[model samples]
Every structure is written in structure tokens, then in C-alpha cells.
Target: MTRSIDTLLVANRGEIACRVMRTAKSLGLTTVAVHSAVDANARHAREADIKINLGGAKPAESYLLADKIIAAAKAAGAQAIHPGYGFLSENASFAQAIADAGLIFLGPPASAIIAMGSKSAAKALMETAGVPLVPGYHGDNQDYETFREAAQRIGYPVLLKATAGGGGKGMKVVEKEADLKQALESAQREAQSSFGDPKMLVEKYVLKPRHVEIQIFADEHGNCIYLNERDCSIQRRHQKVVEEAPAPGLTLELRQAMGESAVRAAQAIGYVGAGTVEFLLDARGEFFFMEMNTRLQVEHPVTELITGQDLVAWQIRIARGEKLPLTQDQVPLNGHAIEVRLYAEDPDNDFLPATGTLDLYREASAGEGRRIDSGIEQGDSISPFYDPMISKLIAWGSNREEARQRLLAMLADTQIAGVRTNLAFLSRILAHPAFAKAELDTGFIERHTEQLFVKPSTQSAHFWKLAAAAWALSEPKTTRQDDPNSPWANNCGLRIAQPRRFLLHLACGEEQQKITLREADLAGVCLTNDRLILEQHGQRTSHSAIRQGNTLYLELDGQIHSISAVDSIALAEAAAHPQGGLTAPMNGSIVRVLVSPEQQVAEGDVLVVLEAMKMEHSIRAPHAGTVQAIFCSEGEMVSDGMVLVEITGDAA
Candidate 1:
């Protein structure tokens, strides 16, 4: 029986809410959006047919307040509620409350949520169900010494994870005994903040295990099926950056084993609707159950693309007491799909979350096998109160190679201006040789951090091309009406002669790219032996500039390039320090300083520890150097790229 739900209330914000609204609308359901004061004008809120204000700016005052959400649902006259992925999605109590209020919760049952909500309890249940699990301590004792001893017994390099939470928050990798206490404290704090539970569990860290998860959907009639697996091994700071369905290197035999395990896990909990069973696969092909998310995952779209299924629709069907429409053997997965998370973050600066209004956010066309799920608009403000992800770019292709190429092209065409982002960094990683071969693991980012965030080479001639374009755009010009013989009169009525030369400074690290441009034409703009062609079409502009912010204003390729003049001296100074020493990565307090003035250290040695975003990051020595000075002390707050230590070493 396909019961129609007239109105559904979305109890979350950002991308996931917008994503849910699309599915709800397709099902002929009128959507209601609940938002906090900060999000009253958000994209999701504005798009919904009905909107309700929760009357507060903070999470607790609005989204996290169960009563407030319930009232908003009732006020909007919604018959069902979609929690999206975060906030209260996994809150079993909230789920139960929604059911009690006679409103359908578009997720698994309350019992299923509670069963898999606690990491320790879920591991125990999985073990009982004969699912392979990592060997570690998931006991009830909360003694620090006991955990420390247990970690040592499990061996060094263990992972401390929040037993009551999901996401990357409240997680830490302890490589040695010296860092155990700090890691534990940090994890506990983060766990408390994220899940209101500070208890954590320790597990042996799998050095090179692939992070793969199985997407499963179950109906009320006890029918459950796995939608296939996704490889989420490409991560930084324990958070997934890129995810792909039909894991590149997985074998059919292994996939069967993992898929069966995932099904069994879901069945064990009597789960309904959409959920995911995550696992860690070792190089030896042995797999261990990580955890079960009893709610929709952020990476579900990848599974949908590969399986040709509407997962959200399936969830709605199950909520309405529908039986499974398909069987295990009947389900099919075709082609390879990859999704990359575009965030407002600085990868070179330790992937710190950035906040600002999106001045320009444009995604590639849907054709050519590209799909984009985004929540931000051109003027949307990325607030510091929530996750910094701006959008998820997904691409599908006939095969892995085609998918990879299409994804790269999509990224190239996609542009986000105004705030710093990980666009270039993501592109570099996708194009990396290791990534192309699908040699992936949780440590992939850490192992290739240097190559991944390498400073742009100054010796490249493209640097001069960008400088020339910047100079040309900055030069003052007169219309063609001013002079009939002007070169600008040839095509459009734009004319310029002896345009004033403008200076530009581009800094990569310690190196500086300085140049001046006076004129620009179809052939190319000249700058100290460098020539750059200015392709113009309407307001769009494209140039061979190597650095960001090189092009100013021009009409090229149906896009507008508005160039702003930057201080040449500041650019020179920035360029002078091409390798700008060791700096703090995010907005965090300096927990410790490992070096003092004139202290010599080798590459990769710990220089400073910064605690930010509820995680601890150790800033290491870039190369062999003598520490010239230290700019901060313990407990001092620092922003992204704030120089914490200066090292004198090889210039190159």
C-alpha cells in the first residue's frame, strides 16, 4: 500500500535537508522546512513549501531541541519527519518521541537505532551475530589507566573512538604511549560535545585497511538487501573526502562476503529503511565490522547511482509499511561512480573549516554523467556553527577510467569563489598516480600529504601567463568609440591603446612571481617573455594563470572574470617566502611547543601541537632545520597558517 504523506518536516539544515526535499517532492509530498534563526533564510528553508522558525541561532536552542522540533512539525501540520543525517537523526529518544507524536520518522525503528547507537554495544551484538570485529576493549570500565593498559596490550597505534557517536568527531589515533593521555582527553571532550557521551572504546589501528561500507535497506516485513559497497578510504583527519561505489579494487568474492555480513548485521537489529554497515578490510582480505549507522548516510547517493535505485523513496515506502519490492539476486549494480565532497576548507592549512558568504558557486552541467547535490547558493553564508561542506559532486561513467576523467573535468569546470576551499587539493589527489590505481586506505592522505599539498612550482611559465592576464585586466582602457583604429574595435566596440601597465605579485610559498602587463589582445598579452591569450566571450574569462586571483575582469567563454587589484608589495612579500615556514593549520590553541629557538630538528619531527575542531594535529618539521624562533606558547589561540615556528634550512 503506497500511502501518500501530504507534508513532511525536515529537521535538519544544509545539504542533506535539500537532498531530502528533492526526494519528498518527487513523491508528491509537500515539504516543510524547520530552521534556526541563523538558517531561516537557508536554501532548504526557502525551497520548502512551508517553513517554520525554531526561534534560536544555536543548535541547542533550535535544531537539537527535541521539543522545539516537535512543535514546529505540529505547527506546520507535517505527517512525517526526516532527520537527514546529523543533528537528531541517530537520537533514539528523539525517534521514539516522533513515533509517539503520531508522526512517521523516515528512518529505522527506535529499537534498531538504540541497538546500533552505542559503539561498544553494537560491536558486542555484531560479535554475537558472528560478524567479524576488531579485537579491542569495549568494556564498561571508564578508568584511564585501564584503557591505557588495554591500548598497550592491543599494541601501539590504536584508535580511540567515541562509543556513542558517529562522524570523525571524538576520534584519535595514538601511535605511542607518550601521546595516549592527550589523545584520550581530546577524544573524550569531542565525544561529549558531539554526542553528550564522553565514553570511548579503543581498537587496534589497521595500518593500511580500506574503509568500505555496505548500504542496506530493510522493510517492515523483515526483507532486507544490501545495495553494494562504497570505498571511503580517501580521507583526511578521519573524515571521508572521496567516496566511490563498486569499490575499485574489490573482488566479487570479497564483495559477496562483505555484503552478506552487512545484511546479517542489519537483520540482527531488525533495521528498517536505509542504513549502512561500515567495515575495515585489511590487506589480507580479512574484514571487520566497524559500526552500523541506523540512518541515511551522506554517501548514499553513490550507492543509488550504481544501483539505479531511489533509496529515499525506498525509505518512504518502508515507512508506509511496504514490502521489499526487489530480492537480493534481482538487484543489479552497473558502472562505476565517484563522489567528492567540496568544502570551504584549506587543505594546506590543516583542513580548517572556513566561514564566509559564497560569492560565486557554479557547478558543471548535469550532462556528461555528472551529478551535484548542493545546499549553498551564490549568496549563501557558510556559518561557523555547522559543517563547512558546500556540496557533493558525483560523476558516473561506463567504467572507472571514464568516471575518473569525467570527475576531473567536472571539478575543472566547477568554481567557487569568495572563500578558501579544497578544490585544487581535491583535484590533485584525484589526479594522483596512486589514487588512479585505486591504491587506497585510511592512511592515504597522511602518507601523501606532502605531494598532495605541494606548492605550485614558480619555474613554470604558466605563472607568467597569469601575471600577464592580471596586468592586462587591471590596465585602464577606453571604448572603441574613443578611437576608430583601436584594436578593441575589430571585434566588439572595446578599444584600448597604450593601456597603463599594472604590477602583480604572486606568492606560492617563499618564492615570488612578479610581472607587469600593459596590453592584451587575441594573440596574447606580453609580460617579461611570457605571452597569455585572453579568450573572451560575454562576461566569462579564461587564462593560463597558475595562481588563484590572477585574472581580474574580462569576458571569456560565456563567463565573467572580475579581477580586483591586489597590493603589489604584499604579493611580493608573500611570493618572497615561497616556503612560508611551519604555521598553524586551523583555529586552535597551541597545546604544546616541541621546539625552541635554534633547536635543530629533522623532517617529520613534531614541532608543535594544535588542538582545533576537537582534534589534535602535530605540526611537523618540513625539513632539516634549526628553529629560528617560536611565536606562540602553550594555550595560545592561533588562526590558520599563523606561523608558530620559523626554521632556517635549505632554500629550495
Candidate 2:
């Protein structure tokens, strides 16, 4: 079965695709890229040796179409196909199809994928294989009453998850019986939309547990070995936000126990190639299997950094009938590595995905300890059609503290503009004393919300002054050569025999402030290399600043603040429509509009649900009001800030 692969096709898009291709090319294999029409000019497509147009932007239309992907592989003369960890990555039928087409599938056998494909089925199999499992119901009975009864039996707090998917989609936590029905409905809807499967399972929600997962690899020779573990406890909404390798504070005995258990789970299903078995480790060192990801994980780079191995290269070799690269005893845990996902999301806005052009994408310099894995470049757009992850910043150091401090510095040096991101939120987490001390768990974000969710509005008066100066200095000015004393030449309110003064209105997020700038205050302000330098009060300071039209994106203390210079007329108009309606928080399609015009609703009632980046976000009623009108219909695409509903507030 040692078949040679001279060409490899990546049947995916974005960073994972690009990352896989980089390895394939390094191994002298011709790399092929399959892309949708929207990704025709994407970084992955442009970097591949051969590119195929898959013809649609949506996952269903392009990436998930197994037949189209197979055809693309055949047409591109590819000998093997690599499904890069997303759409179709864990699809058993897709894997079987690739094998039937006489091309190598760079993943586990289709049988292994099917065995672990369903959460309910996987738990049953794991139970038979002697693997530890959390107490929950993983049965075929998905009825509401069944789940309600299960919840009552398991406890008040339980987790409802889509049986067929991961990545936090179709997952909900029901704290009590009152919240179970609606939570189940929403979870089912999201499950059906995201995974094409509405099956669900209820599990006892473990409290204060750390999410530790073991990375394992196997080959055709029935050889399998675990590659240590990753601590992925820092999360929001059940999705991992930060990951580090060689989980802190794990004893050798526990590591061996978990690693051996993970290998057993994989071998039970005859797993091959790269895989990860996730577990929830309680404080007492007991771990239970959560699930298994049959494809390469998003946090695989952290493992690679610590192990000094190319997992993609190993996957290729494994498919060619190679043996495991390293035995469990030989797998070296070198230095420590930590990674943070840089998402195009507003951390202050419930981490809702944001979409826009990456107007000024500049990553920190990658050297010995700093690494940046990204598929986006400057001017690239983060569309609503896919995941809004801009990049991942990873740092490796001699120890855990060294890695943490290095990652903190990396977060500081990185910059992203045009779209809201979690950059500042990441920096705060790294700098937090608890995190530095390795106090990690799934509820870390919730526990430290007061400190992590610091508002940009806490900026000082001097910060606002600098912002105003940058805006004023960036103003477009024209001068007449014939008249050196033209008033227009000095646009900063230059006047005859008077102190130059101007009223500036700046808005950051929902907070707006008016700062009066006088000539004396701005006399020492100058712009250089996209930085604003201030020489005021006999002190000098500089800030990274840029003016894109009337919006000033200033970097103060490693956080990007988007300040819009609003005119009085615009401000008056905004105040005029204080209660006009609810606007879309981000660009997406209206999945459901629950309220009809003229219908009365209470405050906090769910009204409109929008689907963006393959996730659904609900827009609720802001106050008790009557729905005056709804401007959007189901399936209609909407932009951020576009008014979707108009309501007339009820008078007390």
C-alpha cells in the first residue's frame, strides 16, 4: 500500500489550505488548490501550483460538494486530496468517495471517521472501549421530553450539543427546566444549518474543568502514538480562544494515563493519520472523553511548535503507508508554545463575528520565538461567508512563563484595522496575573470579565487630545503658491490676531466626546511614518495613528481605537432616531423574523435572528414596544448597522 503521491490537492480554503500547501510544496509535491468564486483571488488559490474554480461562495455550493472536489482533483492531475479541517473534513462519505476514485485520502479511514462521527455513537463506542466518559445521555431519542427527563436526572445544569458537529455550533447550556425547550429548538436549528444533522445529545455540564486534549497520529501499520497535550481552557461561548502545548501542571503519571487512553481510543477504530481526542479534566485529575476530531485541529501548530514536527508532512507520509514518525517515549516535549486566535470579532459585543476589509493588516515580526500563521494580507476582506479568523499568533519559549511573556509581546506588536477584533482582549488575558500563574479553565473569560472586557472609553484626556491632533493633522489641505497667507493652507483654525481653536467631535464605539483644541496645544503635533508625535508640557510621546477618511484608527498602548470624527449635523441626526429600531450588528442573512408588524413585544424578547459566518445571532427587542414595521425578510442579506426593525416605544 505504499503508493507515491506526486501531487496533492487541498480541498479547502483559507489559512488551513495555505498551511497544508506550504508543507506539500516543501516536500516537492505539486500542490493544487480548490476555491470558490469568492476565493478566486484568495491567498491559497494564488499560492498553489494549480488552481480549480469550485464555483460558489457558500460551503454547500463549493467546499461541501464532494463530487465537485473529486472532479477538481482528477482534473488537476492530483494523486491525493487533503481536506483541510472544515467542510467535508470529517465527512465519512467524502473520505470513502476519495478512496473509490483511486486517489489517496490524507486522513483516517472512512470507518474511523464514521465510528466517531456522531457524538452519541462515539460515546457508546468509547464506553465499550473502557474510555472514561462524562455522565450524560447519548441516545437516539432526541425528543424534547427525553432531553427534559434526561436533564432532570443528570442535574439542572447540562449542555445540549449537536450530535454530528463540533466547533461550538448547535451548542447551548440550559441552567434550568424553564430554559430547556427554547435552547433545544435553537440548538437544533443551528445544528441542521451547520451540520445538516438535527440530532442532539444532552450531557452533564462539568464545572470548573480544564479542556485538555491529546494529539495522536497513526499509520497503516497499526502503529499509533500520542503527541502530548494542549490546554485549551481559555474560551468564550464554548469555542477555544487560546491554546498552549504541554498543558501546565500535568504530572507524568496523568500524562501517561491520558496519552495511553487517547491511543486506545484511536486504535479501537483503526484510526490513521492525524487526530485529536478531547477530554474534560476535573480538578482532581480525572479526565473524561468529550469527543474526537478526526481531522487536523486548529491548534495543531502549537503542538508542532513544541514537538518540532510537521504534522501535515506526517499526514502525507502516513497516507503513503509510512509508520508513525515518533514513538510515545521518543516524542520530545521541547519548549512551551502558546497560541491565540486573532478573530475578526468584537469582544465587547459578545464576540460576534465582524466582516470588512483588512485595511491595515500588519503582523508582528516572526523570528526565533514568534510565529504568525495567517492567510489574509492587507486590503483583503473578511467576508460573512466564512470564519472570521484573521490570523493566529503563536510564541514558543524555554518555559511556560517565557512563552506567556513572549506571546504578550507578540500581541502588543500586532495590528489589525478596518474590522473589529479580539486583539486587545487577548493582550489582557496574557497579561492577567491568574493566566500567568496558569489558572486556566473553560470559564476563565467569564470569571475575569471585569478585567478582560476593559472598555476603550477608559482613555485619558491626553489620548483624546492626541486623537484630535491626528485628525486635524491628517486633514486634506491645499495651498496657493501665489498667496503664501492663504487661510485654507492652515486648516487647523488659523485666524488673524486670535488663538487658533476648533471644536472636534470624536466617537469610539458608543461613547462620544467633544474636545476643544487650541493652537498652542497642537503647536508641537506632527505626523511621521503613520505616527503622531506630541511635544507638549515639555514631554514627548508618540502613537501609531492613521486617518482613513474621517475615521481615525489610533493605537494607544497596544489597543486599536477607531475614532470617527462626526459632524454636528450627523450627531443631531443620530440623536433624532434614538428609538428608530434595532439594527443588524454584523453583515449576515436574516434567518428568521419572529415578530410581525404592529405586534407588541416585551423587552429582551427575541425578534430577529441573523446568520453570519455559519453562526446564528439573535437580535432582541431593546425595550417594551410595538413593532411598527420590519424592513427585512427571511433570507435577505443585511449589512452591519442596517435597520431591520422599527418599533414605537410604549410610554410609561
- CA lDDT, every prediction? 0.79, 0.89
Candidate 1 lDDT, tens digit per residue, 467-583?
Answer: 446455434445467786877644334345645444666443345556664444324433221123444454433442212344332222222233444567776896887755677
At residue 22, give the lDDT of candidate 1.
96
Model 2 per-residue lDDT tens digits across residues 310-331 = 9999999998888888877899
Model 1 TM-score, 2 decimals:
0.81
- Deviation from native of the Cα of residue 218 in model 1, angstroms: 0.6
lDDT of 2: 0.89
Name the runs in model 1 displaced over 4 angstroms.
Answer: 1-4, 456-461, 474-515, 520-522, 525-563, 567-652
Best of the candidates, lDDT: 2
Q: What range of 10 consecutive residues in model 2 has the weakest lDDT sum?
A: 486-495
Measured against the true structure, the TM-scores of the candidates, in listed sequence, are 0.81, 0.93
Q: How does candidate 1 score on lDDT? A: 0.79
Worst 10 residues of 1 by lDDT: 551-560
Candidate 1, residue 357: how far the Cα is off, in Å: 2.7
**Model 2: clashing residue pairs?**
none
